[model samples]
Target: MRVLVVSAPLVGHAFPLVPLAVALRDAGDDVLLATGGGALAAADAGLPVHDVAPGFDFGRIALRVLPRHPLVARAELAGTAGTRGAGLLFGALNDQLTDPVVALADRWRPDLVLHEPFAVAGAVAAARLDVPAVRQENSLFDGRELVRATGARLGATLRRHGLTELPPPAAAIAVAPPSVAVQDGWPMRYASYVGGGELPSWLREPGERPRVLVTRSTLTGPGDRGPMPAVVAAAAQVDAEFVLVRPDGRSARSLPGNVRVVDWIPLGEALPASAALVHHGGAGSALGALAAGLPQLATVGPGDRRHNAELVARRGAGLALRPRDVTAEALTRLLTDDGLRAAAGQVSREIAAMPAPADLVPRLAALV
Candidate 1:
């Protein structure tokens, strides 16, 4: 079978789909990835890719769409407001992608289409080609609700392609642990894929003290060091070694004595060696920490970060702190709190109990 995989132009939207795509490929299915922006990094995982939106600027689109909705701009979008914002933002993204993705799908003649929730363009293209499309949840939010909200924005695109409305996916792939977010559909273990990078020799083993892994969002500009400086400052007061990922333009001379910086490394490689994690509450980072059984401190940011962080805290696996609330005490608790560690371990076990990606290949094939 030939499968066409579609993703929004962000790593948070793209990377989560990698494990399943790889599993399908290993099972003798041909898989082609269609995406843009930060998601282009997925090619580093060795998947065949087609850029659906050549020279598209998603950041610019976000800037144009977000401010039009004040609540969304402030990250206060929730309930109906959240749904509207998701439509305006992700709908705009899909609008740019729909034509190109449909063209690609028309040429590829895929038997199945797999997509992250935000990449509704995949669903559209699949409908156009009269093929089965599957929704893969990559975060804690409801994929159905988000997709429903995108309907109004996609009307023109749908009309252009002879679709009255977006069809529901043939099936859904659920990865979040039930303790954090209860979801329906085939349960697959959340797998972390942080792309390829050179691992520093020092990272191969545990450090002299407990190691705390710290990271920020990949979507931000190099100058936007959200909550990282505070985490680094708190590292100076703690006894543990801090490994900061992609610290961007920050220099070694200005960093704390106990902090180490790496431009990039796979979290799959970094988590096992670390005692705890500190990061902006991206869906990928939060799930990666839980899968590793590591206590984490999720500094809440805009959009789904708050939702992801709150779920982590409510489940007793971690804490959600505002940027100003990030301090030495919270950082220390991430390493020293036994209850947090235990809860994290429990979540990890729950994740482990889910079906592996390879195990779901036959089920997806049956759909085809």
Candidate 2:
């Protein structure tokens, strides 16, 4: 079977989707990952890639959707949870990929379309191509409402492709802890794959003290750069060492002693040695930390990050902090807390018990 795997063109989305695509590839199925600008990142990771929106920058659309500062953007979400912003951005991003994906699927004739849940373009393309479309869960919470919120717009777009309504996913690949699955699907074990990169030699050696990880979501573009400085300050207060992953050109400043910053490294490689992760409540970071059984201190932000943070708190695996409320003291305290580690272990065990990605291949093959 030939699989067309698509996702939002970002590191976070690519990281999670590739593991599943690799499983299929390893199982002797042909696989190609299609995205916008993220195709370059995927190609660097050694995946066969196709570009839909060749020059698409999600950050450009994100800045447009919430043009104000982070505080104003934060307040906008706080009001209606910014359903309008989410819908509009979803429409914009999907609009870029929809036609291109449909064209590629038409020429390529893929057997299945497995995609990040937010990439409505793939589902619509699959519907038009008459292939089984699978909605791969992108976050800890259900975002079906966002898709439904833009139903009129999405429906109108699909109409151009001769699709009257968007078809339901042939299968839904869910990696979130089952308790948090608002819309359950095939529960697959998360075979953690952050990127196709080699771990640095310095990272291989054990740190002098307990190491802490600080990161934010790949989707939080230029508009949300405010949190990085605060996160760096908080890490300075902690007695442990800090490993900051994927902090780009603009956000990589203000490093105190006992801190090491790397442009990119697989979380699977780094998490095993770390005591805990301090992150914006992105689904990738939260689930990745849980996969490693590392305690987490999540700073909640827009979209489902708030819900994901609440789940972290509810499960007792970590403390959830609001962006305005987070402090160096809280960072120090989370690093020192024993209970968080214990709670994290429980989440880890749950993830381990789920079916591994390879275990899911034969099952997905049957769908074809």
Candidate 3:
């Protein structure tokens, strides 16, 4: 079968599709990934790639807007009502949503289309081509409140184009653990939990001292908000060595004595050594910690971060703090607290026992 995978320009949106694409190729299906320039380099290595248009550089836009329009920053960091505003602000910058993907569908027609949830253009293109489009959600946009918050603006855009009445696609894949409960009302009939890519080579097993992992989401570009200095301070207070991974060089600034920075370290490699994780609470990062049985200190900033943090705290696996309150004292407490650590380990074991994506891939394949 020939599958066309449509991804957004952002790394967060594009990277999750990589493992699925590789899986499809291994299964003897032809997979072609379509996105803008943002993920072209990664796709070029092996996966077939087709550029939809010039990618949107959200980092540059954030730097310009975050200071003056705090709502823009909130939208960029917190996954709240602000995302609708950001989408509206940036949507006018490119018309690719309606044009490029539709044009491409005309040329490389495939049996099915796989798309990121935020990649509205790709979904529309699949609809236009009259092919089966499978929508993939990479984050925690699950409950009714979150759905209403994030989808309001995009829904309006579709309505304006006379596309409001269309039913949702054939399937929706959740790339997270099933423990992360989603609203039952979502349109998806099928949901699968897929973890992130394999672990990197540099990580070591846990030692005598507690180990903590610090990372931001890969989608948040270099200029995106991160409390690196505070991360360093927190590591110092906990007496833990910090292994920081920022895939896009977002956190490459001056480091403290106890902190080690890497451009990209696989979570699989880093999680086993980690007693606790300090992160921006992206779904992938949160699930990575859960899969590893590590507790989390979620310092949430933007979309779904707050929700993911709430889940962690509610489950008793960790503490969730706002960016401003993520102090060294809090970090120390999270790292040393026995109850929270124990809860995290328990949750991790639960997550590990759940069905892996390899099992679900064939189920999805059967749908086609």
Candidate 4:
């Protein structure tokens, strides 16, 4: 089978598709990954790549909301109204890339098209070609519901665009643990959970001192421009050594003697030894920590971080704090809290026993 995978521009949005693409290739299916950014990373991983037109500028939207209030910004972006923002963002994105995507579909003529929810243009193109189109949602938010809810609010706009009829996805594959609830009343015939990806190489090792991994999600990149400084400051007060992953190297400033910053490290290499993690609570990061059984300190910035943080706290695996208000004292409390650590361990064990991506492939095959 020939499969064309459509992904968004950001690394966070694109990376979750890697394991599935690799699985498809290994199974003797031809897989072509089409993305706007992180094409090099995917190509380096041995997946065939096709560069599509650039998607939306959510980074600009994030910058607009970060400094003023991370929580409110996140709420606005992830809430029902924010779904409209997503639709507008992708509608403009689709408008920009429609011609190229249509051309690609015409040329590639794959058996199926798998896409990130934000890459709506791929969905439209697949429809135009009359091929099966499946959406892969890797984050905590529900895209089908978000889009459906947004469509209700933008009924006139949707009607104006002749989108009154909802397009049923061939499948919606969610990459979350089974512990997470799949939304009720969604079209289950086409919607299923596939679970999260494997640990990166770095988290597999055992270390002496308790390690604390700090990152601002893959999308935040490595720039002093994000909330890392606050994490560094808070981490300085803890007993553990910090393994900081700033792949972009934009955030290398005066560092504490105990803090070590690297451009990149496999999360699997670091998480096993780490007693706790501090992150912006992207779904991948949160699930990585859960897989490792590490307690978390979530300094939620934007997007699904707030919801992920709430899940973390509800699961009793960690504490959630606002980026603006995070302090060394708070970090120390979460790291040293025994009950939280034990609870995190329980959650981790639960995640570890769940099915991996390898197990999800057949289910995905059934979807196709």
Best by TM-score: 1
- After TM-score superposition, the amount by which residue 48's alpha carbon in candidate 3 deviates from its true location, in angstroms, is 1.1
For candidate 4, the lDDT comes to 0.64
TM-score for model 2?
Answer: 0.89
Query: Where is model 3 more than 4 Å wrong at Cα?
Result: 59-83, 86-95, 143-166, 183-202, 219-223, 247-256
lDDT tens per residue, model 3, 1-368: 77888776666667667766777778888888888656665564478888776745756555654567666555555556444544543443223454777777778887778877666566666677777777766565552233233344456555654576334667767644455555332222122223334454546677557767777755645324555556765555667777776633434556666777665555666667677888887666676677677788886566557777888888888888876687878888877889887887887766666555455567567767
* Per-residue lDDT of model 2, residues 241-263, tens digit only: 88777776665676788778877
- Write one digit per residue (lDDT tens) for candidate 4, span 104-201: 88899987888776766566667777788887775666778654543343444334345554477777765554454353222221111122345455
Best by lDDT: 1
Q: Which stretches of candidate 4 lie over 4 Å from their true place?
A: 54-84, 149-166, 178-206, 220-227, 247-251
Against the hidden true structure, what lDDT does model 2 obtain?
0.75
Off by over 4 Å in 1: 76-81, 221-224, 251-253
Of models 2 and 3, which has the larger lDDT?
2
Error in Å for residue 79 of model 4: 8.4
Per-model TM against the reference: 0.95, 0.89, 0.80, 0.79
Candidates, ranked, lDDT: 1, 2, 4, 3
Report the Cα lDDT for candidate 1: 0.85
